[model samples]
Target: MDKYDVVVIGGGPGGYVAAIRAAQLGGKVCVIEKGHLGGTCLNRGCIPSKAIITSMKLLSLIKSSSSFGIDVQGYQINFPKVISRKDEVVLKLRQGIGGLFKAKKIDLKNGDYSNRFRAA
Candidate 1:
C-alpha cells in the first residue's frame, strides 16, 4: 500500500480542503471518496439545486419582463436542457477540485474508507 502523511476519508469540502492543505504543507496526502468529488454539496445538493433555482429565477424574470418595459414573447422552458446545464456546472466544479488535487500532488482514491479507519 502507498503510504501517506494525510489520508482524508471523504472528498467533501472539508476532506478535500484538508488534503490539499496537507499536500501544500509538503505532506503526502490521499483523498478517499466513495462518490464524485465535491461531495453532496456539489453533486446532489447545493450546486445542482442552485442551478435549477437560478434557471427558474431567470424564467420568472423573463415572464415579468413586461413590467420592466421589455417586450418578450414565445419563451419555451427546456427542462432537459436546464438539467443538462446543471450537470455541466457540477462537472466543471468537480474537475476544478480534481485539478487542484493534481497540482498539489494529492492522490485521489475511489472507495469508502470510513469503515477502515477508527478513532483510537
Candidate 2:
C-alpha cells in the first residue's frame, strides 16, 4: 500500500550501504533488517572473527620472534581483552551505520527480510 523508491533487505554491509546510497541519490528508501545493523559480517562472522584472528596472529608473531633476535616471555592470550576489543569494534561500526541511516533520513524496519517485507 505504501510506496518506496528502493527497498533493501538484509541490512548487512551491502544492504545498508545500498539503502543509504539510494537515499543519497534522491530515492525514498527503507531497510528491513532482521537483526542488528552491519549484518553477519559485522556481528558474528567476519569482523569479530578477524579481530580475534589478528590478536592470535600477534600472539604467534610475538612467540616466534626469537628468530629475529626479539626476546619475549610470560605472554598469554587474554581472551577477555580480545573479546572486548572485538565487541568494541562491532559496536562502533554498528553505531556508525545507525548514524548514517539517521543522517540520510532512511526508514528502518526491524524485521526478517529474508523472504518477505511489506511497507504500510
Q: Give per-residue CA lDDT, model 2, range 1-120, as digits (tens).
A: 557899887789899989999999999999988799998889999999999999999999998999999999889888999999999999999999999999998888897656654434
Error of 2 at 11 (Å): 0.3
Model 2 local distance difference test score: 0.90
Please give the range of 10 consecutive residues that has the lowest summed lDDT in model 1: 111-120
Give the number of the best model, judged by lDDT: 1
* Alpha-carbon deviation at 49 in model 1, angstroms: 0.5
- Residue 84 alpha-carbon offset, candidate 1, angstroms: 0.5
The Cα RMSD in angstroms, rounded to one decimal, for candidate 2 relative to the true structure is 2.7
What is the lDDT, from 0 to 100, of the residue 16 in candidate 2? 91
Candidate 1 local lDDT, 1-120, one digit each (tens): 688888888999999999988998999999999999998999999999999999999999999999999989999899999999999999999999999999999999997676677554
Once model 2 is optimally superposed onto the true structure by TM-score, how far is the C-alpha of residue 25 displaced, in angstroms? 1.3
